[model samples]
Target: MRIDAHHHVWQIARGDYGWRTPQLAPIYRDFGVEDLAPLLAAAGIGGTILVQAAPSEAETDFLLQVAAASETIRGVVGWTDFDAPDAAARIDELAEQPLLVGLRPMVQDLADDDWLLRPHLAAPLAAMARHGLVFDALVLPRHLPRLIRLCRRHPELAVVLDHCAKPPLKGGDLSSWRADIAELAQSPNVVCKISGLATEAAPGWTVADLRRAVDHVRDCYGAARLLWGSDWPVVNLAGDYALWFAAADALFADLADAERAAVFGGNAARVYLRRRGRGGSRR
Candidate 1:
């Protein structure tokens, strides 16, 4: 069962996506399941995890509603105010929805690099651990140390680092990002997603431009700890889904069949779906 573990669906008219400005004209409009289903079909993608684009709980509910209607969406990574005093209760409430598998705070957009290490987040994170909800760390390279500290504090929480911590692909420097990724990988509780890199690269990026970063992640996390994600409409900002998917395929082509299966789908099932089985026989 193949899963595109990270992607988003948003409606512009909803007025929740603060980041969706005119500058992002390529993907500034509404992107619903209707727009994505065909692409999934063409790629032979069996299932997907519909992730949060907006930080509003209303948007999370909207994503949950979409997941409920779309057979292709196997799980959802929703968002909420992690710093809210009632966050634990909120997470417990959201956990009632069986498809709600994870939560993500927009850490990358925050001004503070140590935001994840804030004391107030402990309770909410503990509640997430108790509810079996994964924490998708939407972070940048600079934020990785604090994330590592958070992982250490809550050893049981399942944390997946999104987008290889949004590495400096465009700037062409991996030294800091590489060291931080390696440090974070030391925590068995943390996993990394091989997604969103296409958008981080300069326009007209070749597969070679991405090879080193991909290889570095593979070395740090291994097949079992790494998962593949399309990042969908956001990926359209730098390259199309087909192009990114093909690039990922070529990059991991040297892996053994079982390792390939784990990176492509199995690890996502294990990490996000919390399922030991291979994700319901691929939709």
Candidate 2:
């Protein structure tokens, strides 16, 4: 039941990836399930939650198609026009597909730091709450205050923070991010993903470079509220899948067996997959 709760797949030919430029050469090419299956196999990962790479309904539909075809993809965190007038209807339509486990509005890429607290997004968020969809917050540290407010505003919505809010590991400052993370964790409804940290560190970062942040997240959220993810291809920007996975394993090696299972797989299943009865096969 080992689950890599956050990862992505994209076809560069689709032209929707504005961020996938030549500068990110390590992962700029097309990456589908075929590219990831062996990596998951070698890591003993049984399933993954395929997430959206582009901010388009078409891309969401594309991810749904990929999830529908792949057994290993246990769930999908697709995109939708959360501010659209018809957002509720759009969410209802997507929810009919069953494999659509959650929705993510690329909040990190948006310029407004308080975008999560915008008045207009309330109705759409209510729609998501009604549909039992998780809100994957793709945010940065600056967005955390608004995120805390949003969680307080919608206590029913299951929100998960992606990439530890893209911490400033490279900047060597954990004080601010640590304080904010503790505040956000106060909400019983919010959870944090232990993924994508390596990519935020200094080039060729060792596991030691990631220890403080990882340890802090564990201390704040504990095993029950934490989940593991690979962030895959994007992880290639800092290191490869094997490197990050090994680092994560070493970081949590001291936990008791049950707690370790919850962090690595059970929490993701209970948060994302079990709600949809989409429990996938074990490796």
Candidate 3:
């Protein structure tokens, strides 16, 4: 099963994602499994991991409920107040929902630079670590210092760095970002996602533009610690679904079919350890 390791589900009424501008109005529509089936089907993508986008635990519960009803959604990366006084109990409750696979802090908007290592966040992060939950580090270039500090402090928490640490491909300043990413990839507890480059590139970016960052991640993380994600609607900001996927497909098409499958889906299965009869991806 070709699994999309990252995607988001949200409702306008639930809580507004202030980032959703009128420019992103197309995605503002409701996108449930019903809307996703065709996209997944067309791409031969079998299952996906539904990640959290809202700021509330209520959104996590809602995603879990949706995953429960759909075979296409094989896993979920939900959000939680890791600093909450009842964090352990809350995680225990989330674990009961079977498909709940991980957690994300929406790290991009966190107010304080040191928030990741603050005393309040420790208990929640530790709780997730105890439960063997992978935490997706959603960060931008500015947050790398703190992110690195947190990973160094909690070597046990498995983290998948979203968007190759969100490089600025369009700006063409790859020096510092690549260095930081290489440093981060050295950690055995972390993995990198070769996804979301389209959104960060020049509006007309093609296969070659993606090659730089893709090559960086492929070189740094290797096949084993790398996963693939669509970052769908967000990718739409730069190009359509087929257009975005075609870039990676082009870059890896020269490799053997097995290697191609590893980037598309196999890496995610190995990282998340999905159940039997679910994945058809090659390692």
TM-score of 3: 0.92
lDDT per residue (tens digit) for residues 1-283 in model 3: 6778888776776665676756786677666778677888888998788888876888888988888888778788988887678987898777666677788888788787667768777777777787767788889887777788788888988888998878988876888888888888778888988777888898798888888888888888887777888887677678777887777778777777787788788888876654332343221
Which digits, one per residue and each the tens of the lDDT, describe model 1 over residues 82-142?
Answer: 8888999999898888888899999999988788878999999999999889999999888
Sliding window of 10 residues with minimal summed lDDT for model 1: 274-283
Candidate 2 lDDT over residue span 1-283, tens digit each: 8999999999999999998899989988999999999999999988899999899999989998898898798889999988788888888888887888899999988887878888988888888888889999999998898899999999999999999998899866778889999999999999999999998999989989999899999999999999999999899988899999999999999999999999999999999975555555421
Between candidates 1 and 3, the one scoring higher on TM-score is 1
Cα shift from native, residue 123, model 3 (Å): 2.0
TM-score of each: 0.97, 0.97, 0.92
> What's model 1's TM-score?
0.97
What value of lDDT does candidate 3 attain over all alpha carbons? Answer: 0.79
